[model samples]
Target: MSDSVPMTPECYARLQEELKNRIKVDRPKVVQDIAEARSHGDLSENAEYDAAKDRQAHIEGRIAELNDKLARAEVIDPKSINTDKIVFGATVTLFDTDSDNEVVYQIVGEDEADIKQGKISVTSPVGKALIGHTLDDEVRINVPSGTRIYEVTEIEYK
Candidate 1:
């Protein structure tokens, strides 16, 4: 897809580092492994060679994916965003109306989203509903389970 991948500055740096490691460190190591496996015996019955080849393919695919993502990345710095409304990279606290519990989530890129860490992708249901909403705004999100209603309580950049 030609659509840009939106990410925080931190996420952009992390992806760049991973791409470098895959190219400079992992790529060479996989190549050497393949060479060693090929030297062992005939290719028809060499399990090591097959496995190494598979690993090499995986590495190459990942490298290509990383390159494409980096090329289309649109990095946004959370600290530099100045607005009261919810946006990408905003850490938001919401009061769940049904459960009467407060939940915190950080709006982040898809690559950086971790539910356990309270980070949600900007394209997610909750995140989509929270976008452009300000403190005290009531957001209704339609999730897989059912509909969820939440009140915006707090929003932080970092």
Candidate 2:
């Protein structure tokens, strides 16, 4: 199954930068580390060699994954979004119906989610429930813990 996730232009640019860094700086360094480790001793008992090989594999896999995501990315500028309704890339401020606490979240792409920064992935349960909703709408989201209700209070693009 394939679903396209919209990413901001800034997120896309960051992905490109990461891909370039991994391919140009990280890949060669790992390969060289593996080569040097191999020169130290036999592979049967070489921890450094094994670790380097594992790191190399992980780096290559991430590079390929990033490339795939970049190829499929639909870049949208967050600043261009102008809707009172919640949508991808919108910063939503909500009043928790259950707790009566205000919360703000930026709906972002999967790779950009950081709860500490108040950015939630568009695919998250709460984010999904909030999408297409406008101010004064009550949103009920089913989370792993339980159901939570939030009232939409504000939406911003930045």
Judging by lDDT against the true structure, name the best candidate. Answer: 1
Quote model 2's TM-score: 0.92
**Model 2 spans with C-alpha error above 4 angstroms:** none
Q: Work out the TM-score per prediction.
A: 0.96, 0.92
lDDT of 2: 0.91
Write model 1 residue lDDT over 1-158, tens digit each, in one string: 99999999889999999999999999999999999998997999999999989999999999999999999999989999999999999999999999999999999999999999999999988888999999999999998989999999999998
Range of the 10 consecutive residues with the lowest summed lDDT in candidate 1:
123-132
What is the lDDT, from 0 to 100, of the residue 43 in candidate 2?
98
RMSD of 2: 1.5
lDDT of each: 0.94, 0.91
